[model samples]
Target: MSVRPVVRQLFRIEQLVDMLLALTGKEISRLQQILRSGTVVYHYYRYWWEGFEAVTEDLQVLLAKFPDADPSQAFRAEQCTAAAIEQAETQAPAKKMEVEIPREAASRKRLLRARSLWECLMQLAHENIPAYKTYSYGRHADIYVWEILPDVRGRLEKAVERFAPRELRAPLRRILQSSGALRLRFFVPR
Candidate 1:
């Protein structure tokens, strides 16, 4: 094979990578928009999960192409942009989960999925992109307070103890404290 063909192929691959990066950035922006929109709808839970899957797929393609292309800056920029949009669009009152989140077992399942997706996104951002400082403090703690805490109110300590991974205790306690909905001692060690 002539050097000319090899060079042409390399240029084509580079162009393809650039296109993929741009498309992925757009996907990330849309995902952020979905997050910033408002209360997590049951239907939207699947959407959010799918969005993360798309972003992961894009990241894989990017890594395959460059192996060193840090798209972290792109992700960070989108997060900021989404936050600004969210702030501007915040004129409407937050819709309470009472109506949106049902107490049924199926709804509870979806709610857990939503919480998992939130954690997954946070982990991705923390590891790959810049951290959102509020995430650790209780970015979406209301879900837990409104959904899980209510079911286990009488047995708060026991419920919290039963919760696995053990990392969720302290922040959850802080959220509960700040919320003023319930007063319970968090027995889990910090």
Candidate 2:
């Protein structure tokens, strides 16, 4: 009941809160990747759907559980992020969807996309976090990315310098900033 003990308890609680925030951020991030990939309702639709629902519900429950916390702003920010992605995908013209590229070219384009996707995700995690405030611990940076950030970043850097043809390298590095979009339109099968 003394001042020292009260401060000690408060410090300990903050540490616990930070860890919880990191874990929650990481979990929601994983869900976002699944949702972004359009795989939630794929072959394993039921399983992913159940898990996604649970994670989304956990967000609502977290709000209720934290009495002093007002995460309305964060929730609204998240909604805006989702809306932005929706708008970007829907606004593109159907005619633009058709394009012709070889398999070798497609692979390069995908690698470009992989790097772009990684960068976009990291930026979002760093700046435009969708979770509750004070929880942007960024502990989920390397969580599920098949290739690590540094490796992808390094490759992207090298790709910029290594490719001899401007036509080949220009589009990849011209990175169009988006939430989780890989705008590889009209990649025709060879």
Number of the predicted model whose lDDT against the real structure is largest: 2
Candidate 2 deviant stretches above 4 angstroms: 1-90, 93-154, 175-180, 183-190
The CA-based lDDT of model 2 is what? Answer: 0.33
Candidate 1 similarity to native, TM-score: 0.19
Enumerate clash totals for all models, in the order shown: 0, 1
lDDT of each: 0.29, 0.33
Instruction: Tell me the tens digit of each residue's lDDT in model 2 across 4-90.
Output: 221222223234333444434435455445544432232222212222233566554543443332344333221121111111243
| Candidates' RMSD to native | 20.2, 18.6
How far does residue 129 in candidate 1 sit from its true spot (Å)?
Answer: 36
Q: Looking at model 1, report the run of 10 residues with the lowest lDDT sum.
A: 80-89
Q: How close is candidate 2 to the true structure, as a TM-score?
A: 0.20
Query: Where is the poorest 10-residue window by lDDT in model 2?
Result: 78-87
